[model samples]
Structure formats: structure tokens, C-alpha cells
Target: MPLLRLLCATLLLAAAAHACRDGGTSGEPPPAGGGGGGGGDGGGDGGGGGGAPTTPGWIERARENFEGGALPASAFAPDPVPDDGPFSDGGAYFTSRGVTPPAAFRATQPFGKDGWLTVESYSRRGDARLADHAEVVADPAGGANHVLRLRSQQHTDGTVVRPTAPLPSRYRVSLRAGFPAFGDGEAGGNNGYDAGDETAGPWWPEERAASQNGFYWLTILDALPRPHNNTWIHHHRKVVIDSDNHHPAWMETWTGDEFVWSGEHPIMMIALDGSRPGDVKTGNAFFSWSNGAWQPSGAIRAVDAYLPDRWYRVTIERDGPRYTLEVSGTFRYGGEGTYRAEIDAAQRCVWHYPVDAAEAAGAAGCVDEGAFVEGHPRWPAGGAWPDWFMFGDPHVNYYEGEVYYDDVVLEVWRD
Candidate 1:
């Protein structure tokens, strides 16, 4: 069953690359590089089954564990505390869509009441009809059994975050997240996922960001206002398409912009930012567990169970220009562990990017090549801080489903 699951996922991965679309930006995956990326060669059972990573001396700056049943005052837009933003008079959002918001929606604040955080989308593209929602609700995965759920059948690309004052260049962010699970029987969600075919090799994850039904694409968590673009973690580093010296050697026709994990796999990809011209913000690592290894064959590795409904915690910490991405958690097909057994984060990887200069400069180098600082002229120096961590189709290419987030936190590294 595990082998079959992995096979089905790989088949879809290649197609996902070409099929994935992009919005709010016109860009393709980084051009093939002079060398293949490193780290894809190493991977193991990942520390025993379960729990989140640990960080010492990191002071928490902002946190949201939606146990209160509503986004706290810290989640809404800043200031004078009025009945707006997430707490609008009601229907404005739906009225724009030509539908009347339920009367009950008018009675209680559905979006949010007050908070230090707010919701924003990287792409302004919004659908009027399908669905659009953001609020706190019950969950079987959250540490507190509650979380902030955001969705947009309209596929309005967005993410939730806490507004803040700029701080030192170094900090860390962590949170628990997962897609909503339905169909208790086929319940875990990955009932019939197919990236297309097995042996197709690792395909670009982010497809064309145009109109999409919204499958969980990629998760971006990193410090913003800095040179490191967290979402860029989805970077394909080098598309390999339209080139001869590509690294993977298997995916030669691929031309997608990001690495799209099919499902049931704790996978990630990275490329050095400046490996080639126009490859700024690219990543330099890939972590798809498979065949008992991370990036076993350079693609994804499925767990013993299903994926869709499983929850996982992701944490990204940045110090200067360097970043570390850590993931933890176990998942069953659904919260009930009915369809299959619990899939521990056994295929997980604790990866750090931008290998040292000498190594990165090597043939299969993994290094960051962007140039920017704490307050570079490119990004405004001071003002309300931008979203530090966001989920739910941030690319604005295409996604029409909802995802949950809980115990979202931002912290500063204590020197």
C-alpha cells in the first residue's frame, strides 16, 4: 500500500509542475543550474514518531491559539478598535459576490473580533461565487483542539498574520497546520491522489497559478521585509527544462516554477538564489521522503498512511541570511486513524539552506545569491510589519479549498 501510494504521488508530481499556474507574478522556475543540489542524498526515519521541534532562548513575540472560538483582538486590523476589517457590518464581502450573508453571520463576528493580526492576500484576484471564509473553529489536530480556518471558494489568495513593529533581523516562526478532512470513510482525503504516474521523476510542485480547485500546494513560513522570501522555499532552484546540464537528469521536460508535493509526504525543495541570472530567492535543498530516505530519488516519499486530513507543525527560523526549516507531527488518513494506521513524521527532514560559500560555489552548490539587508531601499524601512507567516494558496495562482492554523507564533532569537 505504501509503495503504491508513493507511485501514484510521483506520477502526479510531474504533471502538477506543468499544470500548476502562477498569478500576481509572471515568472517560471529558475533556469537549470550548473550543478545538482545537495542534501537530496541524505534522509532517515527522522527522529522517533511525533511531536514538534524545539527552540531554546527564542522569545515569543506574537502567538495565536484560537481556543477562544474567535480570532482575538490581536488578529484584526490595527488601531482604534472599530467594527471593521474582519468585523465589518457583514455582507460587504458577500454583497460584492452578489449573495446575502446569513442573518446569523450578522449576529456574531464570523471573520474576527479584534487582534494584532489580520488576513491579506499576495494576489488581489478574488472569486465572487464559490466560497470565502476566515474564522476560528474546532479541530481534531490543533494542540488546543481549535484553530483559525481560512477558505475561499472564490480562490481569493490569502494568509493570516500578526501586524508588528520591525525588529532585529533575526527571528523564528512556528505553527500547527493542516487541510480540513472530510469523508470519514475515504476520510483521510488521499483516497485517489495521482500525480499522474510513477517513475516520472520529481516534478515542479507549483503549477500555473490560474483558476485551480485548490489543493494544498506549499507552505511558506519565514521572516519577511528581509531578503529571504519564505514562499520562495517552494523554489525549483533550477527548472532543468530548456537545458542540458540539469541535475535530476529524470525531469528534462519540466518547466514549472515550484515543487508541488503530491500528498502523504513530508517533502521540501530549495535552490540557491543566484545560481543563475534571474534566479533570485531560489532555494537549494529538496526533502521528499521515499524508499526509506528523504528525496530518496529526488522526489517525494509517502508515509504509511493517507495525507489530506493529517496535521503537521512547521517551524522556520532565520538568522542573518540563513534559514532553517523544521517539521514534525503524525497523521492518520483522518483524525480517527480509521482508514489506516497513524503516519508518523518519520519521513521528515530538518533542513538548513545556503550551504557555506565554498560548498555552494561547488558544482552542485546550494547557496543563496540575493543581496538585501534589514532595511534595504527595496523594502520600506519602517511601518506596520507585513505578514510573517501565511498559508492558504498564497501564490494566487489557483486554490479553492480551506486550511486550518493554530498556535501560530513569531519569536526573536536571543543572542
Candidate 2:
């Protein structure tokens, strides 16, 4: 297990019991407030102008606040999206204050016009449980600097409240999140965890059954700020999984931690071994993750593989099993001929819960990595992969463990 350490260049140790306050882990320092805002014009398909509100439908322009040298008011230029409304993160973007999505922002699916993005103070999985609450506050011009805030037992048992919607290809996303009670990673010295990464893979450790932490939160995928900087498209979301699992206790970092300049498809995922379940997604190929193993994505000249979590980037572009897997932007694995055209790339696939090993084994033969292989001591699916599993430990104060997630972008063409 990794030894728990504090952030910055400071060292302050305390007992796990009294180390944190009610909202965060014990012994952690409070996060510093007051950040600076930058100056930039808004950018996006949706653009317009600002002045005194004359029409009834058009929303009123917003005023800027520059307490500690932030952006000035004139920076709030108006640019209406073509038929598209104002961009938004989740529901209420700000937690410290009662904020709402700009009038231009509206729901696209489920119930359009009806408020789709919302915020709350708490949530639960089963019965009457008090989890933390969160909200999102969008910037006036639909630019960056969107904020999020949440607190309480919401940190335990996979209790989460997030907004889901279709997204664009180019944009920048950022957030300012913190825990009031604990410093950062000080609650479950031996057992807390949280993370924000791609929504693909088993929820537990590389090998484990349930979550050691009680709760978790993160913005999976979001839009980039404007002024149309190509770099905004590639910046990935940050994932944190806090738990009271391993001995010494620590936190997990995912692929989205790095800031990219541009790319397609933005997605994020968080998990709890026992409290939450498993999830996966693939396209133009088939994939299976059970029995602690890794398998190729398709059957044609195309390819399939898990993108690397650390420094390397993995991409599998193929029409069938006869595909290629590139690591660190270089070709690491793939096939030339053999059964190339037999496998056609798939569109979509997902595994939720109540799925069994036999069902997992029956899904596909593509996942055969060490973690999902047979005879692996920690393979929770028993010799096969199940869609979902449980999360959380009642007796433990925090669910703690390590989680690694990486995001991969695929660009495929057939032969």
C-alpha cells in the first residue's frame, strides 16, 4: 500500500479519527479560496451580443466581478448559439451561492425545455441516506471558469449527482472542487478513494470486490471555454476517488489529468468496488472484461486494447480483428492478415449489474488481461466478467483504494 502523504511541500500528520472535520478527512488543511479570472472573448457555435435587454425572450447581459483582479464587466460580450442554447456544465454550476444555468441553456433530450441540469445538497443509493449535494454554475458568455461545490457523506458509497447530455468536439473544461472537513487525502488513512476518468472498466481495484470508501464525485466530460483555442478540445476532465481502503490510504489519478489541445469524444468515469458497479464502452469492435484478462476489440484488420493509464496513449483503429493497437502514439500491437475482415467494428456495449461470470465469459473473448484472467485471486467475477458489483464497507469509516483510468480516442478506416 502507498504511504499517505499531504499535498504541496508540507507535512502534517494526525490520527485518522480526529484528523478531519465533518466534510473532509481529518488533519487536512482547508483549500485556499479566491482565484483569478482571465480576459478573453467567448467562442462557440452559439454567439450573439449584449446591451440593455429590449426583447422579452433574450436574456439580460451579466455583470462581471473583479474582486482580486478578475475579468472586467465589458468582457461579458453576448454571442447567441445558432438554435443551440447557452452551454452549461451540470445544473446549478456554483455551490457557494444559489446559481442557475443561464436562460439560454436548456435540456436537449428526455424532457427538453424542462430544467435538465439540477443541484442538490445530498443524495443516497438505497433508502434514507444523506449523501453530499453539488451544483454547476455556467459563465455568462458560456466560456470557462465554470465552478462546482459539494459536501458531506456524499463522499461515501458511490452516491453521486451529475448531468448527462450530448457534447461537441472542441471545447475546454475546468473545475474548482474541495472538501471542507479533510485536507484532501486525510480521511480514511487506510481506506478512502475517489476518481474521475473514462467510464470504462470494472469499478474495483485492478483486483478487488468492493469499495473501501463511502462516497465519491467528479465531472465526467464537459465543454471547453471559448475564444476557440484548439487546445481547449484536448484538455481532459480530472477524476478523484477518495476511500478508506488500503493501509496508509491515498487517492487515484486518471488519464483526464493531462490537458490536451484538441480531440474528439470526451468521457469520464468513477467507481466503488462494493458500493458501485462496473461499466465499459466500445465502437467498431467487440470487447469483454471478465476473468482478469484483456482481449482484442474486433476480428478484422482493425484492433482493440486498453489505452495506457500512465504516460502512454493507446488507440485501436480497425474494421475487424486484423487491426492495430498503438501505444504512446506508436504501434505496439495489431494484426496484418489472418482473420482480418471477419470482425466488424461494433457500435456500442455496456455491462451494468446482476451479470454473471458465465454471462461475462459468454459476452466475448477479447478481455484476457492479468486482472481479469482465470485463477487470479482478486477477480471478483469469479472466472468470468459480470456487468456490475456492490460497493462500500459499513464498519470502516472510509472506503479506501487505488484506481487508474485512461481515455483513448479512436479514428478508424477499413481496408
Predicted candidate 1 versus true structure: per-residue lDDT over 1-415, tens digit per residue: 9999999999987666656553212355434532232211121112212454533566665566766555432222211212222112121322343433221110112232234455443323322211235666778554547776766443223343433443345666667767643111122332222221212101122432221233232233223311111223233221110000111122211112333233222223221222222322223333333223334233433322325566766665556444455545553322332111111111221122222333223323322233222222211112112124434433222233466777766677653
Clash tally, candidates in order:
40, 110
Candidate 2 lands at a TM-score of 0.25
> Which is the leading candidate under lDDT?
1
Tens digits of per-residue lDDT for model 2 on 1-415? 1344444223443444344545455455545432222222211122223443333222111111111221111111122322211111111112113433122211111111122222212112233222122223332224554433233332322212222232111111211122212122223332222342211111111332122222222222122211111111112111112222222232222222323221111111221121111222111122322112223333111121122121222222222212222223211122121111111211122211113444344334333233211332222333332111111111111222222111111111211
**TM-scores for all predictions:** 0.43, 0.25
Misplaced by over 4 Å in model 1 are 1-56, 72-116, 121-131, 140-144, 160-167, 181-266, 269-273, 278-306, 331-387
In angstroms, give how far residue 112 of model 1 lies from its true place: 10
Query: Which regions of candidate 2 deviate over 4 angstroms?
Result: 1-132, 135-148, 154-161, 169-171, 179-246, 249-415
